[model samples]
Target: MKVGITGASGYVGQFIVRHFLQRGYTVRVLLRNVQKTKIFCAPDGRFEWTCGDMSNDVVLSEFVDGVHAVVHGAYDHLPGRYRGGEGDNLTGFLESNLNRSLALMQLAHGAGVEKFVFISSRAVYASGHLRGNLQEHSAAQPDTFYGAYKAAVEAMVSAWAYQLHWHAVSLRLTGVYGVVNPLARSKWYDIARAVVRGEEYSQGRNATEVHGDDVARAVELLLHEADARGQAVNCSDRLVSNREIAEIIQSISGERGPLPPQAKAVSPAVMDCAYLQRKGFRFGGVGRLRQSLRELVEAVQKEQRSSQ
Candidate 1:
């Protein structure tokens, strides 16, 4: 099987590449910068990297040729930073994220790619607070521009699957972490560092955590599982409070920070993974969280030592 992934150098994209390689699939990564691919690809040269942007018709066409499946994991939304530069604000974000994704989907279809897997976000649901468990069929009310863009693209994927006869799977991911680069700061790493320093960390009311490896595994399963087609699965593990997450970070990082005062408890936006569970998607839950945090801390320490 040949699988092509957009944003192959990203945290999620790199993990997907690793997963596909471990499963004996020939992987191709679509990256704008060839230099970035060097950091992720194995020196054995088992995988191929194509240089191109998703919005380019010629590039997108050539990138998906002869690939069995394509996983759309690239997006422009930097977790805490605004990436879309000065322009029609909405258009810039949409072009970089949603429109580019749609174009890639079309290219995949034209190239006879068997399956298209999209990594969406749980933020598509309403923002106030999740009153109950969020099921796949729940109403979507995205509050942020990033969430709105994901929701919009999801709708397009669904339409193409049903009307255009394309096989598609959209996985609404939540709190994917475990990619701890000393130079880069993800939400999880930032929170961990803050807790380690005994600093007060303010975060959004709705957040859930999932290991990046686990998320990649889930996507792999969805790609191979026949029943996953034409379905939107909500992917997440246990619902952990912000305070609980902070405590876990402290415990794993050996950070002796004082716990922050309990702020107002926010309603949980828990994802209903019943469908994934029924499909035999078993994760280590909070244990996965702990293991990921420990790995991140060790990685940070190692990098610090090397720098010194």
Candidate 2:
């Protein structure tokens, strides 16, 4: 089967490309710039690249043509926070993300793609203190522009699936950490860097973490499994406090810096992935989390030494 992916150069997209390639599936990556593809695809020549921007209908249609499935991972963040009286940020985010996603959906449908997988966020659920496990059918009250945009897209994808008879899977992902590019800044990276630098760090309340490889594996499982169709699954694992994560990095890196004092600890935001697991999707669990963090720390240190 041939699979097409947007945002093929991103942290998540790269893993998906590699996952499909290892499984002997033909993969086509939609990249705006061909040069960017060379950097990531240099290690392997298994995947093909199609030059196109998501906004271009012609390009999108061409990219999706003859593909069994398409995974939409591209998301554009607004210039400013989508809060307060200034609704401009929300407008920009919707135009770039929601609008682009809708266009891509239509293009994929027109191209007769069999399945469409959208990587949504866990933020779509109602925000407060997550008192219990958050399931797929949980109430959602997106408070921010980013969350609102994702929620809207999720609804759009579901509607499109019903009307077009297309298999749509929206995976609501939590904090995904793994072997991302060293240059990419994530919460995990930030905490790891602080530990390595022996700098003071502050822990935030309510942060959930998941390994990127586990996320990639989940996507792979969904791609082959017909049961994942027409369903929205939450993808996450056990929650870890920010300070605990920092300490883990320090331990793995062999850094001798004194662990920062624990800040206020808040209730963990639990995302239940029971539906996904029932469909035969598996994660690396706590072990995978440790391994991913170790690999990330080693990669960061290696890059740091090389830079010096």
Best model per TM-score: 2
TM, every model: 0.88, 0.89
What tens-digit string does per-residue lDDT give for candidate 2 at 168-230?
888888876677543544447767777777776775544677776677778877777776666
lDDT of 2: 0.76
Weakest lDDT window of 10 consecutive positions for candidate 2? 78-87
- Point out where model 1 deviates above 4 Å: 41-45, 82-88, 194-206, 253-255
lDDT of 1 by residue, 181-269 (tens): 32355446666667655677776343576777888889888888887777788888766666776788787777766664555666566
How far does residue 42 in candidate 1 sit from its true spot (Å)? 1.8
* lDDT (Cα, 0-100) at 34 in candidate 1: 89
lDDT of each: 0.77, 0.76
Best by lDDT: 1
